[model samples]
Target: MTSAAVNRRQAMGAGLGALAAALAGCSGESGPVRRLRLATGPEGGPYNAFGQALAQAVAASGRRIEIVPVSTAASVNNLRKLDDGSVELALAMADAAGDAVLGRESFPRPAAVTALARVYVNYTHLLVPAAGPVRSVKDLAGRPVAAGAAGSGVQVVAERVLRAAGLSDTSATAPAPPPASAPATERAPDPSADERPLGLAASVSALREGSVDALFWSGGVPTPALSELAGEMPLRFLPLDDYVGALRERYAPVYTAVTLPAGVYGLTEPVGTIGVGNYLLARADVPQGVVRELLQVVFERWRDLLREVTAGARLEPRFAISTGEVPLHPGAVSYYRSVYG
Candidate 1:
C-alpha cells in the first residue's frame, strides 16, 4: 500500500480505539479520565522535551494530558500562568522561582507555587566566535554584544553580570557629550551605539555574521543549536570562574559552580561555569490527588521517561527537596515522603 493509505488506516484504528475507551467509561461509574494541562517552552527547548516525557508517563497511567508549547521567557511567567489557572504545571529556573515567590524583579506579585522536583542545572554560557578578538567579559566593554532576549532568564542573568562589571544598558546606549560644547560635526558616536540585546537565534546569527562580538545564554550543555553553530564557526565558551564567588554572594544561594565536560559539545577541554537548577512548579491550589498521581508517575517511570526525552535524564529524586527559596507544595511533600522517606 502507498504511504498515504497506511497513514489513513492508522488514523482510523486510533479513532476506533478511542471510541471503544469512551464506551467502556460510559458502562461504569468510574467516570471519564481527568485531563491535565502542562506548559512547556519553545520548540527544541529543554522544557518542551520534559513536558513530552511527563505527558507520556501520565498517558501510560490512563490519564489524559495536553502539553502546551510556550516561549522561552523567564520562569516567572510560567509561575504566574499556573497561579492564574492558565496552566496546571510549568518548568522554572530556581533563581526565577525565588524572585517570583518574593515578588522581586520580573514578578510584580508574589507567586504561590510549589515544586514537584528539581530537573537540571542551567549553565550561563558566554560564547564568542573563536576568530573574534574578544577573549574576556572585560573585552566586551565597548564591543557589540547580544545580551539575550528581553524578559528571558538569560537576559536577567546577563544584566546582573553587566552590572557587576559596572556597565548598565542605559549607559551603554547613551551618547557621549561633545567636548567643550564643540560643533555637532566634531562629536563622536557613542561607543555602544551598535550594541543590541536580542533573542537567542538573533544572537547566533549576529555572531555567525561577525556583527556581534559576544553573547550570553543560560541553558543546558550540548544545546543542539549551539552544537550546530560550533560546527560552522569556531566558537569558545568563556569561563566564569573568576566571578563565581561574587555572583553567589549577590544572588540567592541558587548559584553554584559547575563544570561542562569536553566531549559534550566537542570542546577540547572542560568549561568551568556557574549555573542554577531548574524545577517543576505547580500552583498551591492545584488538586492534591492530581499532583500526587503526577509525582507518583514521575518517580515510578523515571527511567522510561528518561529514555523518551533528554530533559528527563536530569530528573533526580534527590533533588526534589533542593529548592532554595520557594516552599514545597503540600502535594509534592506527600509524594516525596512516601518515596524518599
Candidate 2:
C-alpha cells in the first residue's frame, strides 16, 4: 500500500477508537471502569465500617464498578451530599430519609434520592452514668447531654425524642432545672434540657469526663466504640419505649418499639428503645443497571457485610424492601422482583 494511504488508515482507526471510548463512558458499559462515591458516617461508626467492607468486597468481585466511601456526619448529611451530586450513594436512617422526602427536619427541601435497600436497624441508645441521677427521659432537664453530631440522623431523632418528651432544644431556650421524673404533660416545651451536638467519640469522651450526664446515639447493636467504653465504666441505657408512642404520633410512623436485649453493654435485662431502619440511598437519576448491579453484589457478599455491620439478621430481599415512605429505586425494584420470581 502507498505510504499516504497507510497513514490515513491509521488515523481513521484512532478516531474510531476515541469515539467508542466516549460512548462507553456515557453508557457506563464494560469498556470502561465506573467509580461511584458512597457517602457514609463518621469514622468508627457502622455506616463507615459497612461502606469500607462493601468497597473491599465489591473490588474483590472483579466488577467494573468501584465504590469509594466518603465519611460525613451520617444520614442527613449523607443525603445532602447525594442530593448535591457530591456522592452517588448514601447511608441514612429511615426517619431522616422520610423527612428528606417530605422536605422537613435537616433537609430544606425534598431531596432527589431513592432507596436501594433497607440495610439494617439502628437502635436508639440513651446512655447515662450508672451513678447519675438521670433515671428517665424526664430527668434530662437542666442536664447537659450529647445529642449526636450536627446534621446527623442521630441528631434528628434526638430532637424528636426530646420534643416527644415535652422538652425543647436547650440551644434555643435557657436551661432550668425541673423535678426528677416529671410527667410529659407537665414537661411541655420545657427549655431546661441542655443538649450538645457531639459525635460518637466525642460524646463518649464527654460522658467519661463527666462533662455530659447523658448521650444519645443510634447505631447497630453493640457499636464498637460504645462497647469498648462500657468495658471501662459502668454505664446505663435509659429506656425509650415511652417516647416512641409520642414520636410516632407527632412525626412519621418510622419509629418502632424494639428491645435492646440483655448482655449488650452488660445490662441485666432488656432495654426497650426506638428502632429506625437504615437505608442505602442513591440519587434518583442514577442508572437503573448500576443500582441493580450494586444490589446484586450486596446480597451475594452479605456475609462480608455482616462481619462489619452485625445487622442482627441476614440481609434478605423481604426485609430490604421494607424501606417505608422512601421509594425504592427502579433498579432495586427490578432486582427484588427477579429474586421473588
Candidate 3:
C-alpha cells in the first residue's frame, strides 16, 4: 500500500480505539458509573473508615469493580438508604436489620436485603460523671440525659434502652455534640443557629456541664470520644447487663453479653454491657457475581481491611452464620462455604 494510505489507516484505527475507550466508561443502560455506591457512617465513624478501606483495597487489585463510599448516619439509616436503592453496600446493626427483615416494629414491611458479614460487636456505653449520684440505668428517671440525634442508630437504641429501664418520657436528647467530637473539616452549626445532628461532642459537653446526668453511646471498646471524655473528666460506664434480658426479650436475639475490660478507658474496673452485632448489608437484588467478588476483597485481603478499621478483623469465616435475623446473601454464603469447608 502507498505510504500515505498506510498512515491514514493507522490514524483511523487510533481514533476508533479512543472512541471505544470512552464508551467503556459506562455499563450502558445500567447506570452512569460502574463503581458501587456504598453508604457508610458519618465522617470519622468506624463504618466510614471501613467502607473506604474496602474500596481502596478493591481498586488496588486492578479489578473492574470500584466502590464509592457515601457517609451516612450508620445502621438504621444505612438500611433505609439500601432499601431506597440509593446505595449498595451498607453497615448496619443486627437489631435494626432484623427488624426490617422480619417486617416487625419500626419497619412496617420487610426490606429486601441479605446479610454480608457480622463485622463486630458495638459495645453499649452509658457514660455518667464519676462524681455524680447516678450509678445505674434506672437511677436517672427524671434527670436529663443525652440520647443520640434523630434518625441515628444511637437514638433508636438509646430510646429502646430508656424504655427498657422504664425511664420513658424522661431524659433529654442532646441537640449537638461539644467541640471535641465535631469534625474540623465541617463546623457544626451553632445550637442557636439551626437544628444540628447530635453527636458525641454534644453529649460529652452536656454531661460535663451538668446539663445532662448521663449519655448513651455504642461503639468499639475505648470509644474515641469516651476515651477523651475520661481523660478530661472522671467518668463511669453504667452496667447494662441487668437490662440485657429485658432488651433481648423485648427486642431480638441479636443482643449478646459482653464485658469491657478495665483500663480500656482508664476505668479501674470492667463493666458488663449488652453487645449488639454489627453487620455489612447489601440489597437482595445486587448481582451475585459482584457480591461474591466484593466478599473476596473483604475476606481474602483481611489484614488490609483490619488496618483500615481494626473492627473489621472480626469479619471472619467462622462467624459467617451469625446472622440469623437477616438471611445471608447467596454470594457470601457460597464464598464462605468454599473457604470454611
- Quick one: best TM-score, which candidate? 2
lDDT of 2 at 87: 95
Residue 286 of model 3, lDDT score? 80
What does each candidate score in C-alpha RMSD? Answer: 10.1, 5.6, 9.8
List residue ranges in candidate 2 displaced over 4 A: 1-29, 170-191
Which residue pairs clash in candidate 1? none
Estimate TM-scores for all models: 0.80, 0.86, 0.81
Q: lDDT, candidate 1, residue 246?
A: 73
Give the distance in Å from residue 4's predicted Cα in candidate 3 to where it truly belongs. 14
lDDT of 3 by residue, 211-283 (tens): 7888887777667777888899988888888888987887778888888888788978899998888888888
List ranges where model 3 is wrong by over 4 Å.
1-33, 170-197, 307-313
Please give the ranking of all candidate structures by lDDT, highest first, separated by commas: 2, 3, 1
| Residue 266 shift from truth in candidate 3, angstroms | 0.6
Quickly count the clashes in candidate 2: 0
Say which prediction, candidate 1 or candidate 2, comes out ahead on lDDT. 2
> What number of backbone clashes does candidate 3 have, counting pairs of residues 3 or more apart or in separate chains?
5
* lDDT of prediction 3: 0.77
So what's the TM-score on candidate 2? Answer: 0.86
Model 1, 32-98: lDDT tens digits are 4666666666555666676777777677777543434454454656777777788778888788788
